[model samples]
Target: MSSHPTSPRPVADLFAADGRLVAIPRRPARREALLAHLAETLFASGRVYREAEVNEALKTVHEDYPALRRYLVVGGFLARTKDGAAYHRQRTAPLPGGATPSVA
Candidate 1:
C-alpha cells in the first residue's frame, strides 16, 4: 500500500479556518495513468529496480509506489519478485480486439 494517498490535484490548504478538510479536491488518477508512469519509470530505471531505487524513483509521484506497484502486478503491466526486491515492466500486449490504436 502507498504510504501517501494520491490526490489528482494538489491540496493547497487543508483548513484555512479550523484544520478541517474543506473544499476538498478530487484529482484521482486513473489506473492506466499510473501504469503508464510506472512503465516509463521502469524503462528508464534500467531492467531491474531495487526496493530503495523504486521507492526513490516514485516517491515524488506518489507518497509510496507500492500501491501502484501492486496495481501493476495485478494488472499485468509489471512483474515482481515474491519478496519485491526487483521489478520489471511487462512487454505490452496489444489491446483487446487487436486492431492497433491510431496514433494520429
Candidate 2:
C-alpha cells in the first residue's frame, strides 16, 4: 500500500471555494508542496515579518494560523529568528528527509 493519499490531487484543490485551505495534507510530499506554495504566495523574500505579521498573513488563508506557522517553520519553508520575533521565506526548503530541493 502506498503511503500517499488515496488520490493525489493538485495543490489548488486543497483550497475551498472562498480560497481558504480546506485541510492541510498529511502526506509529506503534499504538505511540502502546500507549504512551498504558501511561502511563495504569501511572503516576500528578504522581507522580515514580525510574529503578528506572520499570523495575519496566514490568517488570510486559514483560521488556524498557528498550525500553519508551525508547519512552515518545521518544514523549513520559513526561517525564524532565535527569538521567534521575525520570519522570512526560505529560498529553498529542505524536504522531509533533510534534502534540499534542487534549483533548475
Candidate 3:
C-alpha cells in the first residue's frame, strides 16, 4: 500500500521560512505529511508527554497548540493515553518510493 494518505501535496509547501507552521493542509495526505514531520522532530518516539508538555512543544511551532496537538493525534503521528494525559509519537511508516516527507 502507498504511504500517502490521500492528497499528496509537496511536503515543502506546508511550512514558512521561519520554521513555523504556515497551514495545516485540508487534504489527508498533505496533513499526514505535516504531522509526521512534527511528530518526528518535536517529540521523540519513545518519550511520553504530559498535556502541558505537548502544548508547549506544539506552541514552539504554532500559536494554535491545542489544534496542532489534536491534529497530531488524529493524523496518527501521535498517540495519547486512554485518559488523555500523555502522548508519544507512533511508529512512522515508510513513505512511498522511500521518500521521507519533511517540512523543509
All candidates' TM-scores? Answer: 0.51, 0.80, 0.74
Which segments of candidate 2 are over 4 A away from where they belong?
1-8, 93-104
* Candidate 2 clash pair list: none
lDDT of 2 by residue, 1-104 (tens): 76866776789999999999998888899899899999999998778889999999999999989999999999988888888888888878345778543222
List the global CA lDDT of all models.
0.55, 0.87, 0.79
- Model 1, range 1-104, lDDT digits (tens) per residue? 66776555333242245433343223344445546555765445226666677666655455546675566667766667777777766656665777532211
Predicted candidate 3 versus true structure: per-residue lDDT over 1-104, tens digit per residue: 77865665667777799878787777776677788888888898667788999999898888988888999888778888888987877777676788643321
TM-score result, candidate 1: 0.51
Ranking by TM-score: 2, 3, 1
Task: Say which candidate scores most in TM-score.
Answer: 2
By lDDT rank, best first, the candidates go 2, 3, 1
Evaluation by TM-score, superior candidate among 1 and 2: 2
Off by over 4 Å in 3: 1-9, 94-104
lDDT of 1: 0.55
Considering summed lDDT, which 10 consecutive residues are worst modelled in model 2?
A: 95-104
Candidate 3 or 2, higher lDDT: 2
- Which candidate do you rate higher for TM-score, 1 or 3? 3
TM-score of the candidate numbered 3? 0.74
